[model samples]
Target: MTSTPLHKGIHPVLEQDHPYIFIDACMQAWPDADYAHAHRHGVTAYAVTAFHPWAGLDEALEGLMFWHLSARRHSHLGIAWIAEDIRHAKREGRAVFVLASQGGDFISNALHRIEAFYRLGLRMLIPAYSRTNAICGGCLDRADGGLTSFGELVVAECNRVGLLLDCSHVGKRSSLEIIERSAAPVVFSHSNPKRLVDNPRNIDDEQILACAARGGVIGLAPWGPLVMKPGSRTRPTLDDFVEHIDYVAQLTGSADHIGIGTDMSLGTYPDHEHDPWGEPAYAAVTREYDQHVTADVRSPLRAVEGFSSYPEVLNLVDRLQRRGYGEADVRKILGENMLRVFEQVWR
Candidate 1:
C-alpha cells in the first residue's frame, strides 16, 4: 500500500513569514472547532472576529463578547464595542483586534454608524450574509438585487475610513455593484471559485476576475462545500482544494490575487446546530434534512487528511513543485496576496 504525498516542491519558509492570517470571520460555537490556537500552530499573527448577530447597543455585553479573546496572544478579536480593549491587546502583543460584521445589520440601516465603528477600529464589513438586510441583498435572496442606496453610502464611507469591504456573502449583483462603488480595493475574504464546485456561495469566474482587476484579493476557504462537486459522494481531498486554488489563479492570471483562508471550523459550533445569538440552538431542521448531509460535510478528522495545521499546509508548495507554481507564487497564495489586500484596504 502506498501512502499519499501531501507535498512535492520545497517546503515554504514559514519562519520568515509573519504567520499572519485573517480568519475571514467565524462564530463562537465550539472553541476547539472554530478558534485557531496560535500555540498549537505556531501562528504569529491572527485577526479574529465574530461572524454574526451584530453586536448591538449594549457595550457591556459586547465587551464580554470580546473579553475572552484578550487572553490569547497574537489574536485580533473583533466586536463592535471592544475598541479600548482591542487597542490594549495590540499593545500587549496579544491579538490585534479587528471589529468585523457579517452584515450591515450592526448599524441597523444607519450608514453613519459605520463611521462610529470605524473610529473604534472596525476594519472590515460584510454587506450581507445568507439573508439580505437594510443595506444590501444576499446571495440566497430570491430578488437578486444589487446594493441599496444606503449600501452605496456604506461602501463609500468604508472607503473613506479605509475599511476593507468584504463582498463574500453579498448577492451576485450587489457584489458587482460594490466593486464599482468601493473607493478602495475590496475582498472576498473566504470564498472559492464557483467554477470548481458550482456553489452559489462561491464566486464565479467573472466575479473573481473583476475583484482581481480592482486589486482585490479572494481568499479561498478549505471547507467541504467549496471543494466538493455538486451531488458527488466524496470528501474533499488536498487535490480538490488545490484545484480550486489553481482555478482561481487561472481566473485571475496571477497567484498574487489569491490567498488561503482555510475556514476551518475546528471547534466553534456543532455541525448539527444552528441558531442566532442567545437564541436556543436548533437541531437539524427536519428529519428529511438529515438525508441532505453530504459526504463532504462529514466531521473532519484531526488533520483533515493531508494537512493538520498551517505549517502542514505550507507543504503544498512542495507538492506542486513541478506544477509551474514556484516559491514566490506559493508565498503569494499563503499570505502575500492577503497582505496586499490588507495594506490597500486597511489603510
Candidate 2:
C-alpha cells in the first residue's frame, strides 16, 4: 500500500477513512492472540522487547527465536526490519512486529552480538535496564556511573548497524552520554516525564530536550505512577495520558518529539507459569525494588481506563482531537514521529 503524503495542520479523517499508524514503541512481548487483537484495532506495528535483565544471552536468544517462530506461524503478523515495513503492514492490513533488546546484556560480553542481533531483525537496543550492568549504569543504580568503554562500543556498533538506541531504563549520566555519543537519533521508547511524575523511570526535562535536540522522540508510557501523581485513588484517565504527551510537546515546543509506547504485557503478574519468557524471573528483582516505590499502590498497566486492550487506541485518537491537536500533530504523536526516527537511524 502506498502512503499519503503527510500534511501539516490538516484535520485527519476518521480512522476508517485515513488508516492511522499506531506503533507501540516498547512492549514486553506480543503473543499470537495479542497480534490478532492488534490487527483488529488497526495497530500498524509494535516494537517488542526480547531481552530482560533476569535472562542471560541464551535466554534472550531463545526469546527472540520464539517470537520469530510465532510471527512465522501467524499469517497476519510480519517482522519489521525498516520503516517501509510499517507502511507495508498498514497496506497489507497486518501487524508489523519489531524486536528490541530492553537490556544490553543480551550482547553477553560480546560487542559483535549487536550486529548479529541486527541481522536477526532486532532493531533497537537499551544500554541498561533498572540495574547497572557491565555496559552502562541504570536509573536505579546506586551510583550514576555513565556508559562504560564497552557501553561506548555498543553504542558505536548499534549506530553503525542502524539499530535504534533506547534510553528508557538507562541512568541519567548514561542517557546523556548515549544522546551525545550516537550519531543517529535515539529514543526513550517507553518512558514518562519525571517532572509530571517523580519516578526514576521517567525522563526529566533536561533529558527530554537533549533527545529532542538530536531529533529523537520520547514515547510516553501508559503506566501508572509515570502518568499520574503518587497516592491518587483515581484511575489514570485518557486525559492523564494526554497530559504527559502535552507536557512533552510544550517542553519541546513541538508535538513532533512525542509518541506512545504502552509497555503493557499480555498477562498480569504472578500468572507467569505459561509465559513465553520462562517463570518471570524479573518479578523477584521487582519485588525487591518495588518496596521503595509506589507502583503497588496503583497499577501501572491500567493507568488509562480501557487502555489495557488494544482497541482503545481509537479512543486516544479521539482524545487528541478533542484536545485541539491537529490531525497532523496527532498522527505524528501516534506513530509518524517514531517512524521518522526509525527512518533516520535505520539508514
Best by lDDT: 2
TM-score of each: 0.75, 0.85
lDDT (10s digit) by residue, model 1, range 1-347: 11332221111223433333323232222344323333233232334444444445464236435524543422443332333443343344343334556666777766677777666556677878756777787876667678888788888888887778888878888899999888788888778887776776788977888889899888787665556666655455677678877888777777878876654432333343446666432222122212443332333421234543455664565565657888788767765676666666664
lDDT of 2 by residue, 209-264 (tens): 99999999999987655665665555567788888988988999989899889876
Please state the error at residue 331 of candidate 2 in Å: 0.6
Off by over 4 Å in 1: 1-42, 51-55, 59-98, 270-298, 301-304
Off by over 4 Å in 2: 1-18, 30-37, 267-301
Task: Tell me the deviation in Å of residue 266 in model 2.
Answer: 3.3
User: What global local distance difference test value does model 1 have?
Assistant: 0.59
| Candidate 2 lDDT | 0.76
Q: Give the clashing pairs for model 2.
A: 224-300
28, model 1: CA deviation in Å? 5.9
lDDT of each: 0.59, 0.76
